[model samples]
Target: MDLTNLSYEEGLKELESIIDSLETGELTLEESFNKFKKGVDLYKYLYEILNKVEGEIKIIMEDEEREEDFQLEG
Candidate 1:
């Protein structure tokens, strides 16, 4: 799966599918291990995306506040 191309919601859905598969207890040991690894990778990718979005939102909010302050001053 191309994590970079996936949105946060897609990543989350994939992660949930992985969890369901793991819970089924039907996979071979090797299959389970591979799925677990994939889940971890998906989790990390999602975390990074969330943090980046949060930072961008904070910056945008700060810019808006600065603009409002400037307008008030003027």
Candidate 2:
């Protein structure tokens, strides 16, 4: 699946739908496998997004800490 333009919320919604469908036991084995694979891709994409955001937050926090330290020293 080409998730190049997919937002995190959209991907998450799709993953949830996949899980719901899988739970119903309605799809054939092949269909289930396909959904499973797509879900994995969505999960990875979401994880990467979260990790990037976390890293950015950490950087901002570190910068704030440095500024505070500099002010104290001055």
Candidate 3:
């Protein structure tokens, strides 16, 4: 599956489904391992998206703070 094209919500939903499948103990060993790896990849993708958004938020907050400081000194 192409995780790169998934939205964060979609990736999260897929991960949850993978977890439920693993919990069922129904897959062959190879299939379980493959699903596990895919789940990990989805986790990393979601994490990267979260980190990027967090960085953007920090930058915006910093800019706002600087603007407030400048206004106070004006």
Per-prediction TM-score = 0.91, 0.95, 0.95
Residue range 12-54, candidate 3, lDDT tens digits = 9999999999999999999999999999999999999999999
TM-score of 3: 0.95
In model 3, which residue pairs have backbone atoms overlapping below 3 Å?
none
Worst 10 residues of 1 by lDDT: 1-10
Query: Going through the candidates in order, what is the number of backbone clashes in each?
Result: 0, 0, 0
Worst 10 residues of 2 by lDDT: 1-10
Model 1, span 1-74: residue lDDT tens: 68889989999999999999999999999999999999999999999998999999999999999999999999
Clashing pairs in 2: none
Better of 1 and 3 by TM-score: 3
Estimate the lDDT of model 2: 0.96
The reply for model 2, stretches above 4 Å from the true place, is none
List model 2 lDDT by residue over 45-66, tens digit each.
Answer: 9999999999999999999999
TM-score (C-alpha) between model 2 and the true structure: 0.95
